[model samples]
Target: MKTEKGFSIADLKMNNRLVLAPMAAISDLPFRLLCRKQGASLCYTEMINAEAVARNNKSAFRLAESHPDDQPLGLQLFGARVESMEAAAKKLAGTEKFDFFDLNMGCPDGRVLRQGAGAALLRRETRACELVKAIKEAGKPVTVKVRLNPNVLNSIRVCKALEKAGVDCITVHGRTVKQKYSGPVDFVSIKRITKAVSIPVIANGNIRSRKDVKITLEKTGAAAVMIGRGAIGNPGIFADLQGHLAIKPINAMFNYLKLFEEFGMDKFGRKKTQVIRFLTKVKKQQVIELVQKAGTEEELEQALAELK
Candidate 1:
């Protein structure tokens, strides 16, 4: 199960060290499959609200849905309460749907923090440990994602606690919750945490290119690198890392659209918007304007064909 650039963690075997980070609304079924096809070692579903899943919310269930092709997938759950977290884990375990699970402790959104979830757990170490331990009890391999605490050094302490709670891996986003996504990434603190834990450490944040991936692993000694915004419009970034031909935006867009329709997600306007956002990243201004003006699939396809 081990390759030069890949490793196995519990039951999940990754093909490489590059992972597609869990992104809300952006890491949907079509996008995940696209990234996986492009060589991302693993991909996670957007963070699901534990409370909602515990209540059997249909929308939350849909978010966690996976196909056989989405192997080595991980489901991420977010909640402040041990009861809800445990309940959600149990619910997902019963489905036997995912290769593993991740607990979200790194989200910095105001809405998540206000609910005492996400990055708020960084301040409540005891609660965070309890939540992770509760999920582990579901008998699934679990990982935890976290950001540097107010005191950056505290990341090592938190990571050690998670390891003790039996987390299979740890992904550290190198910015404190307060810093959100701006400013510099704290590679120093990430390296400290990697050294502090026996489990694999996955470094996230500011990873844009293959060189960035190499630099992160070299500097932090992390077992892997997780890319988020960098892969927004460019799943080919993974192919680039694997020394494959860089995929053109038009071709990538065609494949993505085909998969999007195959997944029966065409009714969602937000999904089209997601594709448009990716197009904006790689398309010329005029093409972007045409896509922006597109009101239907035909119009969008016409706009995309111009690039071909």
Candidate 2:
């Protein structure tokens, strides 16, 4: 299904090249719906711990919750154990909700690294491949997201191995583990990977606007672009990138609040954090302070209305 507007990975098809990265404590069901409502073609759940999911952790399962409208969703899994990864994939697949599984081989979080997962897996390509193979046994299209290797361009070999191991797609973040989220993205390395791989290569890192997406796609020749921190405050970035009208962050936040209630998500902590992200761009510091101190959603909503 290669076309001007869409592409296919195995049986899953995406109508556009915009995807929301699986962010910790961020990419929830409501967040996915808002992004998709605007224009994101594919969305992933917040990174779920494979070991936690395998152990049937209620909190981990809650993070993977989705609605019928949240179509073409990918449940992101991160951990080092092949047995745990397999069990987690099987457990989620039995629910018949997720469209695919995204293996998190790119996370630079020290906590994950300490557990022998994330970018650390890049150092263990054999184990990463083994984890992918075990996840594949659960019978779903699997994708791996990774950073540029410690040696940079060496990431090509990692993607190549994952591809040979039957991964449906690979996403290259274009930054080494050492750089984390601070340095410039290596588009040259991403471009080289696109040239080296036969499957779709998604270019990620520092893409925040439509212009940024265009430049990344042109420079890397990637099939799509994944937005990470950029989409946190503005889910409308997807619509803007897709040639639609630019959506105001405040407006999108209101929509998020609506969805928040519609979906019955009661976690005030998650709600407050999302509100703060959506309004972080607002120049009024007092408003953010008020938002932070607001004891209830109503108080927060009233405070946000002041921005309008």
Candidate 3:
């Protein structure tokens, strides 16, 4: 199928304009692969802590891991210090298969904010621009994810600064750091950023359906839409965005479980719990209970088969 106009960052070209947001814990390899299969043009690894990567932390490195099938993936790094961010990016550039790197200035979690790493950068414009410059110097196609600042005008300032720092693209989540995930998304702010920046701008927030995707792209004139919570248990939303029917939850869950095992994720129990919760939103509670009770993957598969 033909895709939206080509989205390129330097020499890298994506198959489509739809991108999967770099969600913490939720955007793991299994979930990314599933989104890719369902039509996500590009996927991002969960936010990686640069300090942990600089320290050679195994867990942090694992978060950035990808397989051959997960091509065109972006590794998002979060850190307040330029040296650590540069060190981590340079090291991963040599060893990782991601096509690009994204600087995380949009995350609003209290932990990230406390470290002055994520949305806190909104207030420290100089430091944020410096970090973008350092990462760009690390020799990779780079992007910055940012949020609308309280002043709104400040968001445009940051986008321009990032572009001047030579970032290839920018993602603008339509809410401020204080709003976090609640309240209405400021699409007008997103539109303003897209108008002010020369590079591609990806619009994120409250994008739950195909109609929402269409409205966002049309209204904001963004290059693409980034799906977060909306894609959790329903990767089929990507297919639906392309005009196909949604994939059955049961079948999608089966595929996710298969990929989960294939990837050999260590936290199967935790992931399984998450899967059950997402499924419960769409599937019967009794069916979810049965799946949860099934201890082994084999048992889980059988239970899913029964649902079919």
Candidate 4:
């Protein structure tokens, strides 16, 4: 599956076809890098607030960080206002060297609904179409990330507009906004969208195992499958997709703890011993008891010292 032309997002040839879904608060630099090492063809930053980008927020800017190894990364942005989104895309295009700009149209958070972003954009076809057009104008590949809206009878209409508007690829989550993360994912909708669009369609939802990935791709006839929540405490799924082998969840936890620590968890004014104590999930009551007996940070250090 390797391409000599290097990796890309749209017309772009990636090292592999597997991609990590842009999850909020989960797909940070360390997590994406870990997945990449595990054989993820490509990975994206967490879905960032488009309005934050337009306003030049430092936290949002930090989300865009990538290393040399994190090639062909997708930068996902979200917002309701087309103008703001366009400006943010243009700004990102000018500075950040991303393989593609992904529009977030699938988030179901209440705050996102309040701002008319995420799944809310799905209902406003005219506006969503315009945003896609603007992203296309940015000279890079335009990808839209969406979920199946429960009330959307015109799903085909929306897909057609996205295609006609020049979106290079579309990633469809199987669940609707109303359904949130509940129930089974509607793979049928994904199949319908796949048949309707000419470009690559990615199927995402409840993909926890290699078996699920295999079945999903076959059932939906999608070009790729995007893994999200399933990869949080488990990254071996990437390795499994590569046909290597599946490791135990304990092994995954060992790796995640190292990753979390190296990525600055220990820098919270605590020594290594104190940090590892919290990381250990022996029992909630035991942790509370340890914290309760400590009169100060020094006492906490002594208590942890005795345990070790």
Q: What are the per-model numbers of colliding residue pairs?
A: 0, 0, 0, 1
Q: Assess the local accuracy of residue 248 in candidate 2 as a C-alpha lDDT between 0 and 100.
A: 86
For residues 1-308, write the lDDT of model 1, one tens digit per residue: 11147866776778789899999978888888888888888899999999999999978888888899998889999999999899999998897488888989999999999999998888888899899889988888999899998676677777888888788999999998878899988888899898888889888999877678888888888888899998887788878876778676556777878788787664456656776767777756787777778888788778778666
Per-residue lDDT over 33-118 for candidate 2, one digit per residue giving the tens place of the 0 to 100 score:
98988888989998999999999998888888898899888889999999999999999999749888999998888899999999
Candidate 2 clashing pairs, residues 3+ apart or interchain: none
The true-versus-predicted C-alpha distance at residue 79 of model 2, in Å, is 0.4
- lDDT scores in order: 0.84, 0.87, 0.85, 0.74
Q: Ten residues in a row with the worst lDDT in model 4?
A: 266-275
Model 4 agreement with the true structure over 69-172: per-residue lDDT tens digits: 77768899888888888888887888776788888888889899789888888888788888888776678888898988664457767877988988888999
Instruction: For candidate 3, write residues 1-308 as lDDT tens digits.
Output: 23466587668888787899998878889888888888899999989999999999998998999999998888999999999988898889888888889999998888989999999998888898888877877688899899999887888988898899888899989988788898998888899999998999988999887778878888888888899988887888788878866676667877777787787777757666757856775857876877789887777666667566
Clashing pairs in 3: none
Q: Order the candidates by TM-score, highest first — what do you get?
A: 2, 1, 3, 4
- Model 1: pairs clashing at backbone N, Cα or C within 3 Å: none
Provide the TM-score for each candidate, comma-separated: 0.93, 0.94, 0.92, 0.81
Q: On a 0 to 100 scale, what is the lDDT of residue 124 in model 1?
A: 80
In model 2, the runs with Cα more than 4 Å from the true position are 1-4, 297-302, 305-308
Winning model by TM-score:
2
